[model samples]
Target: METTSSVADIQMVTFLLGSEEYGVDVMDVREIVDITDVTKVANAPSHVEGVIDLRGSIVPIVSLKKRFGLPEAAAGDYNCIAVMDFAGALTGFVIDEVTDVIRVARRDILPPLELGSEPWMEGILSLGPRLIVVMNLKHLA
Candidate 1:
């Protein structure tokens, strides 16, 4: 068992997709907002869904489903777009829902078990009965 002090050392932002629970480093997350209208951009990469008029600037939104090669997500399923800043660009990731913020320990967290196979699993950290998928945001963004 891990102690609270140890667990609190590591913080993560949790979210839900389908029935699965996933997490990303809280530091990478800039803001979370409800689903917004996305304007499709022609000639953009398939992974690049399009850009949205966020405030006054056009921000790119990427579907986590499409990025991971998962099937197309049903319309209206997502409730939040978790924006992350990487390499000076702000990218929004569409997720089913924002869950909670919690902490875990470096020791309690496990590495990517399917790294060799999945290549994108990054790592896996067990948080109680829920296992959080630690994504490599640098590559993801």
Candidate 2:
């Protein structure tokens, strides 16, 4: 029997924000949960949706739409929170939808272009007809 060596690849969790598809390192993702009631915080940033109790631990949630300056999601829209470790802290990003977890070869990821400055964008990936924008959570936090 012959065995093939595994190729070096990066696993990413893709999600939707508005009409755009974005991805983050799968290792940084903790879990995904349905949208729940978030207690509003006082004097918080515009992107901050509020805080939620996650198994007794309070976690702050950020709205990806607001963070990206996109139009607000319609009320009653189905959404979810993608919990990820940002700067050693657990935070959740409210997204339009959780798409799929895909593995792509390291060579497939390309550097971001200078089409306006996006500090959170780390790279870009082309998967067939889909173009995913890889995000750096460190910059977002």
Among the numbered candidates, top TM-score falls to 2
User: Model 1: which residue pairs collide?
Assistant: none
Off by over 4 Å in 1: 1-8, 114-120
Task: Put down candidate 2 lDDT per residue, 1-141, tens digits, no spaces.
Answer: 533433567789999888899999999999999999999999999999899999998999998888888899787684899999989999989998988998887788898899875888888999889999999888874
Alpha carbon lDDT of residue 16, candidate 2? 89
The Cα local distance difference test for each model comes to 0.77, 0.89
In candidate 2, which residue ranges exceed 4 Å CA deviation? 1-8
| Residue range with the least summed lDDT across 10 consecutive positions in model 2 | 1-10
Scored against the true structure, residue 70 in model 1 reaches a CA lDDT of 71
- With a 3 Å backbone cut-off (N, CA, C), the pairs that clash in candidate 2 are none
- lDDT, model 1: 0.77
